[model samples]
Target chain A: MGEWSNARATSEAAGIGAAGQVQVDDDLALVARVQAGEMAAFDVLTRKYRERIFSIIYNITSNREDAADLTQDAFVRAFTSLSRFKGQSSFFTWLYRIAVNTALSHLKKSRMRRFFSFETINEEMAPGEIVDTLSQKSAGDHSAQLAELQEKLNEALQKLSPKHRTVVVLFEIEGLGHQEIAEIMHTSEGTVRSRLHYAKQQLQADLQSYLS
Target chain B: MKKRRESRHEVSGGVTLEQLLRVKRAERPGPEFWADFDRGLQQKLFKTVVDRRRSGVRNFFRIVLHSRSTYAMPILAAIMVAFGIALNRGSGDGPLPQAVTAPVDMVVSVEANTRASSPGAERFVVDLLNSGGESGNFRKVMSLGSINTPDAGSTRYVADQLGSVTGRGGVLSMGDSF
Candidate 1:
């Protein structure tokens, strides 16, 4: 059994280099090739990032149509501004910043559409029932509930300000570590921890119903 | 009914409502999710780019008009200068005008007189040199004697000097002249 385990470990260790650790690797050779005007490299990057990028937009917007639109916009903007991407950070992190700012800009423009939007949502619905409750809620209610929740989240997010939301998003949803999140957000580990702590407390209080 | 379900799940710290909601959201389905998402994205991108292009064209025209408004004085001045030159030639003002040459020098000095009441103010001998160098290459040396702060009189003085130099087809030196 020990020998078998040793063999498995050797195989896993062998998987640590270049093509083997493709997912964990942050080297954006594909992006670099795209920067050199390689359309095919860009296509590879697009395919790799599309689903994950779409997932982030979907989480924030919660509307498939809008999220998809924003995702495509994010990719196109990334493509156009690819020359400006200095690669001080990984390409993915830079792309994530673009995705977030694009989504936030969209929300800002649609702010008037968000007024009193949360009034009719059932704040008492359990986690499992929340989406279903939303789906069953009036077509108008679906939009209203989503808008309200977003407004609340935005408010809660704003309370911690820019620094905290970035850390929370990078760490919690994106599953990045303190070190990784620190690198992406460009702060020390201590700052990341403080922001994360404050962010969680704010989220817990504001999103208390969502958590319950 | 939803409230009651929500209340049941609101127990202290075990697993927050938000986490459960997240799990539930993960399970929520919109059939043909990926396909629909792709189609929607393409349409939105097309619309946004189209809108930006349209606005960009409008802004180009607006910018051109604004620039013309801003440059009306300089343009008018050039036209007037041309007209004046034509009139002067018609009236015969002593064989047109002579080539103007204005020599300038920047003087800088440090003196150790040590007689000034304020310790900060040290009297020092200075020699200055000012001449036309490429603007990009021009560097500010020691700044003393006459400092052109952004007072209105100073600004107008500089503007008049510049206008006179350009009017007489003379080059303007930025710093001290030797």
Candidate 2:
């Protein structure tokens, strides 16, 4: 098990590195075109990252309408401030920072009006993936049980503080590293790790019934 | 070994946090939503860019209005001072015009009253004030400095007329002029 896990980790790290390199090259080319006064190049960058950016915002806001609006706002801000974007970071990183900051500000302003409404999951996944993962250590009818677990998961997520929720969403859902999350959150990696640990502990306590 | 143990501990729950989060990754809006999103975003971006350009012009004016003392006041004062110097250079014939020497508050009040009164009366008073030499009352006031000269008799005559028009109090004030 240890050997297999180590091998998987190695392969995943290599895959991420290669993917990141390709993304960096593509983003640089697109950003250069934008800097040279080609407005259409920005559309390409927006198209590429819009879904991911939207997903990040959606997880934070939990309201599709607010997410949609904020996603547009983030892209608009990025395009307007594109000239000030020195290539010190990858284009996505800069874009991600903007999107995160926009969402955080929105959350701050609309704190009183926060209400959670979970959306249905429709993406293609291996049949019973969530159920199988859960059932490996417990027991349930994989189909109906998975639905309940999903609802519980979203409830637990919404219960988290915005700061904790943001770190968890970015790290776990978006598969970002602690360092990357630290950069996005504008804090030390140690803070990011601490928040993630506390967030997971809270989730564990909230979903204790489902997990057991 | 510690790192491995930590990794294992992270996934100690029946389902890993990553797997639970994956459930959410699947919860995206449909294709139709994206179709609408792209079109809506395009329109919004175009409007935003255009609005930003418009606001840039507006912001320039706003800054000028707010910071008038800094950039605009000095320029305006300089122009006024230069115009005054030019007017002074040209006016060697006599003392400065009564319009220049008159108290500003009195002129402003007269101008306001003239505007508020009948148009015909406004036109006459404004013309009389502008053409100061011809008006009897104005000529008397202008010649006060030259009372000892040949205009002393004319000054006394005009003062009596002004006293009648302005009443008893006016006659007392005009006594100094005589």
Candidate 3:
């Protein structure tokens, strides 16, 4: 297990380094073009980051429609405020901050109407082999058990407060670093780490049955 | 390595939180939905621009409404003065005749002087002498006179009526009688 983990970690690090560099370069160029009044360049930026932004918003809000609206709102705000962007941070980080703030504001306003529904995972995007391996190691139909786990995970995620949930979504799901999450949340990295710790504890307690 | 170890140690149960969260990474809208997302964002951008323009206009009016009375009154007065000046200038550019510049008192005195100087004055004096100072004959002779001798109170009323009759060139001819 340790060997497998190390190998996976090395591979992921290599992939991330290459992909991260390319994405940063592309984002910088697109942002410059947008600053120069090339609106089509913004469209490229949107396409590149829309899925990630939407996913983060979706996880936080737990409502696809609200996520879609907030995602669009975030992009629109980003476009309008592009001039103020000094490029101190990567474009994605700035965009993430916008998305996070928008989602947080929406959550605050619509606290009464907070309803969460889990979406079914697409087969192509799902880690079928991992689920199969885990399921084989246990005693259950792999797909059915995996679906139940997915449902429980979503419920557990929704049970978290917006702040903690945001940290978890950014750190665990989006695979962002603690520093990046801190920057997005506009909090200290220590606060982010603490939130992540508390959130994982709560989620672990909630999903104890499935995990076992 | 330390960060990775810390992350790994943070997981409470046997299952990693990262793996569990990864399962949900697939929970997204379909490709067709994403294709439509850009179009929707574009529409939202367009709507934002339009709303900003509308709000800008609304805010301008709002500021005008909420401004201090001291500032607002002066601005309003300036606007009214400007409007008056514009109207005055516009009237000057047209070929229309000027309004009656003569005051009613001045007009009456001028008419009296003209009547006294004309040949009609001699006839008026002869008629008055032949009437033996009778009030009815004096009124009849006064009515026969070619000049309108409106009383001080009726002067404005007569002038207004005459001004309308004469149209733009409001000249009171001496031969007019009332």
- For model 2, which pairs clash? none
Off by over 4 Å in 1: A1-21, A24-27, A61-64, A115-166, A183-189, A206-212, B1-6, B9-13, B16-31, B40-178
Q: Give candidate 2's whole-model lDDT.
A: 0.67
Number of the predicted model whose lDDT against the real structure is largest? 3
For model 1, report DockQ.
0.05
Docking class of 1: incorrect
lDDT of 2 by residue, A1-68 (tens): 13223322322322445546776788899887766655557767987888889988999988888898
Structural RMSD, model 2 = 25.0
| TM-score versus the correct structure, for each prediction | 0.45, 0.61, 0.61
Candidate with better DockQ, 2 vs 3:
3
A123 Cα displacement, candidate 3 (Å): 2.6
lDDT of 3 by residue, B1-178 (tens): 5743432333224555566777877786887777567557655665565566578668976777688767886786787798797668546554222212323443344345557754576765654455344323333333333234312212323444346456846433212211
User: Per-model i-RMS in Å?
Assistant: 17.2, 25.0, 23.2
The lDDT ranking, best first, is 3, 2, 1
Mark the 10 consecutive residues where model 2 chain B has the least summed lDDT: B169-178
Could you tell me how far off, in angstroms, the CA of residue B38 lies in candidate 2 after the best superposition?
A: 1.1
Predicted complexes: DockQ each: 0.05, 0.13, 0.15
- Retained true contacts (fraction), each candidate: 0.12, 0.36, 0.43
What C-alpha lDDT, on a 0 to 100 scale, does residue A193 get in candidate 3? Answer: 90
